[model samples]
Target: MNDSLHTVSLIKIALYSAFAFVLSVITVVFITPFFPESAHDFLRFLAEVGIVLAVSLFIVRHLNKKDVSLRSIVGDTSVSKKMLLFSSSLTIGKLILYFLFAGLVLRFFITQPEFAADAQSVMEDTSPPEFNRWLIISTVVLAPVIEEFIFRGIILNKWAEKSSNTRALIISSLLFGLLHIGSFIIPQFIGGLLYGIVYIKTKKLIYPILMHVLNNLIPVGIMLIPAPESTEAFSVSQLIAELTPVLNVVSLVFIIALPVFLFIVYRYSRNLNDEVAPFKFNTRKAI
Candidate 1:
C-alpha cells in the first residue's frame, strides 16, 4: 500500500507503454508525410526528441509526486573503482552475448536472400555525414540520459518500493524493451535487464547512464569503420577472428566473469544502510 508502488502496477506499466507507443506512431504517421524526403531523418529525429522528452518527463514528474522521490533514486553515490569495473564487465558481457546470439540467428535462421537484404539495408545508410554525426550524438548521449532517468531513476525505483529488487528489475527492463518495439526489442530487452541490475546494484543513475553511453558508442564506432562488400561474406566467427583475436579473448573473459560479477554486485546491493541513516533532503516530500 506504499505510495510509490501504488501508481506503478503492472496495469500502469502496460498503459504507459501503450500510450507512448501509440502517441509516437500517430505522430510519425501524421507528421512524416508533410516533410520533404531529404529532411525526413532530421525532422523525425527532432520530433522523437520532443515527444519522448515531453512524455517521459511528465510521467516521471507525476510518479515523483508519489512515495518515490528523485533523491532516493539519485541516491548520493560517487563513482569508484568497483563501480567502473562492474560497469565495464557488464557492458562487455552484453556485447558478447548480443553478438553471439546474433551470430546464431544469422548463421542458422536468416536465409541467403534475407541476409543479402539485411546487408543491403545496413549498408544503405545514405545519410550525409552531418546527419550521421547528429544521430550518433543523440543516441550516445541523449538516449542514455533520458532512458536511464525514466526506466531506472523513475520506474524501477518506484516498483522497488513494494516488490523484490528482482521483480522491479524485470518489470522495468521489460518496459524499457517495450519502448523500442521493433528490431531493437531483443537486444534492448537484454541491455535493459543488465542496466536495471546495474542501477539496483550501484544505486546511482550515473552508472547505468555511463554503461548505456559506452554500450551505444561501441556500435557507432564500429559503424564508422569502412566495411567493404567482400567482408559481407564473413560469418560472425570469421568476422570476429578476422577483426581481432584479442577481442575474442576479451569476450571470453567477460563471458566467464559475468556470473561472478553479477554475484558480487548482488551481494554488494543487498547490504542495507541500517547503521547509517537514510539521506534526507530539505523537505519530507522530497523523500
Candidate 2:
C-alpha cells in the first residue's frame, strides 16, 4: 500500500482479472465434464459472477482506502440539454475513433500472412441467430455495466486519486486492452482510453458506460445486418470493399468532424481540473 497508487492499482487490476479468468476457466472445465453444452454455456455465463463479485470487493477495498471513497466513480449527471449534448457528441466521437482504428487494422495491418489466423477467426465468428442474440446482450449490456464499474468505476477511479487523471486514463486503458486475447487488445485499449477521458471530463459514470455499450453494439449491429448472399467467394480485401463501404464513409466524416467534436469537448472540459481530489463520498453529487 506504500507503493505509488498507480502501481498499487495496476497490481490489483492484474490480480483480480487473473483471479476472475482462472475461476471462469476452472468452472468451464468442471462443467464440461458433467453438463450438456447448453447447460455448460449457461454455467459459463454464471462463472462471470466471479468478475462481478471480485469487482464488488474492489469497490469496498478502494472505498476504505485512506483519502479515497465512492465519489471517484459517481458524479454530477444532470439531465439538462448541455449534459445531453456532451454525452451524445462524446458517444459519437468514441464510435468514430473505434471504427477508425478497427478499419485501419483490417485494411492494412491484417493483410499480413501472420495475421491470417486472426482474420479467419474474425470471419468465422459469424453469428447464429439465437446465440448471437444472447452474445449481443452479454457484450452490449452486461459487459458495459460490469466493465465500466470495474475499469472506469474502480480501477481508473482508484488511480485518479493516487495519480493524475491523465495517468489514470492511460494506465487503466492499457489494463483494459490487456484483458483480451490477440488482436482484440488494441481496439479494446483504444476504447478504454476514450471511455476514461469521457468519465474524467463529465465525471459521469453513465457516459462511459453508455459509450462502452455503444462500442460493443457496433460490431453486433454489423453482424445482424443480413449480408447479400453470393455464389462467388471473395478475398478479405474484396469483401472489405464490398461489405464495409459505410465504414470508409464514416471514417472520412470522422476526420472532417473530429476538430469540431474536440472543440465541443474542450468547451465542456474548461473546469476539468485534474488536481482536484478524485474519491470521496458525496450524497448529492450530480454526476
Best by TM-score: 2
Clashes of 2: 5
lDDT per residue (tens digit) for residues 53-154 in model 2: 776677567546733434444555455567556666677676776667566545554446666566567766666555534445667888888788778776
In candidate 2, position 141 carries an lDDT of 80
- Candidate 1's TM-score: 0.65
Any runs in candidate 1 off by more than 4 Å, and if so which?
A: 1-35, 60-68, 104-133, 184-186, 228-287
* Residue 177 in candidate 2, Cα distance off native in Å: 2.5
lDDT of 1 by residue, 1-287 (tens): 13244564446644765687578768877888997877767766776676567666666656556645556556655799887887877887678666654544444434455655565565566554443565677789878887887787766765666565677778888888888897468778778877877666556677888899999999788878774445345454454344355445545665576687567556755643221112122123343
Prediction 2 global C-alpha lDDT: 0.65
Cα-based lDDT at residue 35, candidate 2: 81
